[model samples]
Target: MTPSLTEAVAQAWPPAEWRDVHLLAAVSGGADSVALLRALHKLKREAGGRGRLLVAHFDHGIRGVASADDARWVAELAEGLGLECRLGVAAGPPPASEQHARDARYRWLAETAGEVGARHIATGHTADDQTETILYRLLRGSGLAGLAGVPPHRPLTAACDVVRPLLEVTRAEVEQHLRALDQPYRTDATNAEPTYARNRMRNELLPALRLEFGEGVDAAIRRAGQQAGEAQQVVGELAARLAGEARIDGSPDEVRLSPALLAAAPPLVAREACKLAWRSAGWPEQSMGAEQWQRLYTLLCDAGTAGLQLPGGVDARWVDSIVVLRRTSAD
Candidate 1:
């Protein structure tokens, strides 16, 4: 039997975390997001109603006028729920990359949240998304951190938190809840197109996996990601503590690490220490992937290797008992 709306909302843990927090729901008019909006709206009417729920939509400008229509649809959906709706649109056509589009969407959401006094920006990222992300990262040879998949909550900006309330709920449960409500949701035509890798995975591989591994495959994958996420949290804490042990030797623009301490450190600790120095030297964190980090760490450990050039114009070199890093003239 399909789960009820109450059952679906029960998995959303935000209300327990903060009282009187304003939430801005990101609705794309899809079933997942629609269910999120409706559930939150219902919860808003209950006793000790944790906070007010508002709606926000972003038009990527890649889908021609259909994207704009989507914004209108979400606004109307909010109206139906007796909530306020806010819309943001990209200035130009969305960049060719999915990452660019995602970045644009969140950047706008963060900015909107700042303007509207919302404490949390909520999206409809479900357990299925966590599964897909873990699988995708595994295919591309990601490390433990990457395998952790989508986090339930993260800092979107200094003032706002990006939260995924449905991470414990499956896509099947979301559709089932919507069915129980007899609600209407619009489908994005682009989801069927296989140009994107994620679309291909969803359209092709996931079904094959289900067939071969049985229906529990999705749940299993999500569990694996959750375990990885938990393990990564421990690693992050260790990394932070290791970063503290590193000897800071220069200004923020040019950071130097103590070679003697790094060489004496364990491999993992040393890598994290180099990462700390790299950040201190003004390197973009996202630009350093797992392999890139491993390579830099290997270089830091080997006396034979002298220097390394990383993305974002950052350069690192060994100088006797210290390693120095500086940003160069490169984009």
Candidate 2:
């Protein structure tokens, strides 16, 4: 049997576990978020709250009046529930792209949460979102880690985490809960726009696939994502250990590794370790693709004579059986 919205939320994050933490819910006046906020409020009431509930909304102004309306609706909704609301409006015109808008929203959420002393930020990402994310990453040739889709929780800062209480709940369930409560929500027309690939996928591709293969397609994909997540956890732990063990010498701008130690590990492990190294040095990885990582892995394993330059002004070369990755002046 499909779980009710409240049951789903409780299953994902029990009141007993989080009733004492200051949580900021990221609500965009959509059905999923509205349901999430309402369900959490109900749980808190039942748990006899020891903590505070905060609502946060970021208006990107992409739709001008509609965008502002969303922020207003979220604030009003929070106010009705007697919860504090934090509203952030983009300083300039709306962001140029969807990615930029998402980035801005998150940055604002983090900042707002810090100001309000929230230890966690909860979002309304549902199971359908997870399936869409997994399919999108698959289409882009993402690796296993990418195929794992959206995580249930992740650290946004040292003291704060972003949690998705509806990760296992379906959008249909959210709408059902909202309908039961006679709650209203804002619908973003941009979600139906054809210009966005995700919109196209959600409207056309997934629906068409479901028609051909039945509803089980979504379940199968979600299962694959769950399996991928489990596998990635194991791989991540090994990579972290390998990265730690192989590091022999390092400075502020450079990291040195034992080529023999790296070569001893599996290719995938070594490659992931290299990624960890890049992150530790604060090097930009926006342009590093599968091919670039593979090249670095090969160089590390083979001790190639030719030195190669990487993105973010990093250079990789083999020196006396040691792999030295240094930040150069040139990109």
Candidate 3:
């Protein structure tokens, strides 16, 4: 007999004491989320736990009826499972884009979890989501950080940990678990719509690749992400060493690298040092395109005196003996 979802989750958290741990489950009333709730509840009961299980549902208010229905369904499911439920509506002015909406949702979730003193906030991100994220980042020319896809645990703050126990499971497995448990879930019609970038990747890009190339394209990309993640760790270490060697100051917001030191370092280390410098100056990750990176590389290698002002008021200047990166005061 195969291990139940509860067993799998328990195995993942084997070292966890499981007592008095407030687990906040982000439930959208979808099959995946519902399955996560059930599995967590089972684990809580089996451990003879003293902790509280809270369900948080956010209504993005995109679809009129469907959005409300999802929140209602999640509340009902939480009640049925004997878990406390909190419902939050995105009531302020709508965000500018879907990406913004998602960011707001996670921010709200993190804030709520902190308010409730929850130690762990669980999200239902399956292997399929991870695979899609990897492919999307790759297509956007993201380096190691993006290729790492989603991490299993992210420290939301000093207090809370954003955990994804379902990272190893696939969407189909979650649906199967829901079916086995006779759990009812709502499917968002918007997920099928190809307007979103992620939806386009899922529906159009991945399918085409699978049909044209072979099956397991998703797995292949995921494997690549794992390898890239490891390689990125190595590169990050080397970059840190180079930063130390080239440093005139330690403040992340303003970095000054010794041009002589940079010139002596390996090419990859030099490139990553520049990336680190830009990141320290508040530039968004992957904001620099390949051409931009190449141009910056050329500037770093050849020019004795050059400066490039980037978007977001960031500017990189190469003086006589040092490369300086700072955010411009101008808005």
Winning candidate number (lDDT): 2
| C-alpha lDDT of candidate 2 relative to the true structure | 0.85
State which candidate has the highest TM-score.
Answer: 2
lDDT of 2 by residue, 92-175 (tens): 875777777788888898999899888889999888888899999898788898899989989998878899999888888888
Residue pairs with backbone atoms closer than 3 Å in model 1 (clashes): none
Higher-ranked by lDDT: 1 or 2: 2
Return the number of clashes found in candidate 1: 0
Give per-model TM-scores.
0.87, 0.92, 0.87
Q: Candidate 1 lDDT, tens digit per residue, 177-249? A: 8888888888772322123788779879999999999999998988888898897777667767767766575
Q: Per-residue lDDT of 228-310 in model 3, one digit per residue for the tens?
A: 88888898899888866776874566767777777777777777877776676566754576667666666666656468876
lDDT of 3: 0.77
**Local accuracy by lDDT, each model:** 0.77, 0.85, 0.77
Least well predicted 10-residue stretch by lDDT in candidate 2: 187-196
